[model samples]
Target: LDSVLVTLEEVTVCFSVEEWALLEEWQRELHREVTAATEQLLASLGRWNLWGLLDMGKILGGSGF
Candidate 1:
């Protein structure tokens, strides 16, 4: 299975407002799982190293396009 961090960064950085703005019925398509998981992880790991958390996400992004 893929690491959550990797895909989370890709979505956050690359996403556009229009692309991410999900309607009520379309909410399931949003990366809710990834976003919540990342936030929780960042909080638990301590917010002192926010940049490090971001970096971990970037690494998971793989060969980014």
Candidate 2:
């Protein structure tokens, strides 16, 4: 995983200024979408009392980033 991240960073470093800016913008948008989805999921879980139905440990433990 570390190696992959290093490779990705190297590739990103090769991008032109405009391309880097666009990539940064896209990443920000993706982060916002993920945050919104997480908020909605939490709200639904709270409303439905589904907390015990899901495993929070496994869900939050992975470093997928």
Residue pairs that clash (backbone atoms under 3 angstroms), model 2? none
23: Cα error in model 1, Å: 9.4
Query: Model 2, residue 12: displacement in angstroms?
Result: 24
Score each candidate by Cα lDDT: 0.48, 0.40
Question: Which RMSD values do the candidates have, in order?
Answer: 9.7, 14.6
lDDT of each residue in 14-56, candidate 1, tens digit only: 4344434433534623454555566677668654355654564
In Å, residue 61's CA in model 1 sits off its true spot by 26
Looking at model 1, report the run of 10 residues with the lowest lDDT sum: 56-65
Clash pairs detected, candidate 1: 6-60
TM-scores across all candidates? 0.36, 0.36
Prediction 1 global C-alpha lDDT: 0.48
Q: State the TM-score for model 1.
A: 0.36
Q: What is the lDDT of residue 19 in candidate 2?
A: 45
Count backbone overlaps in model 1.
1
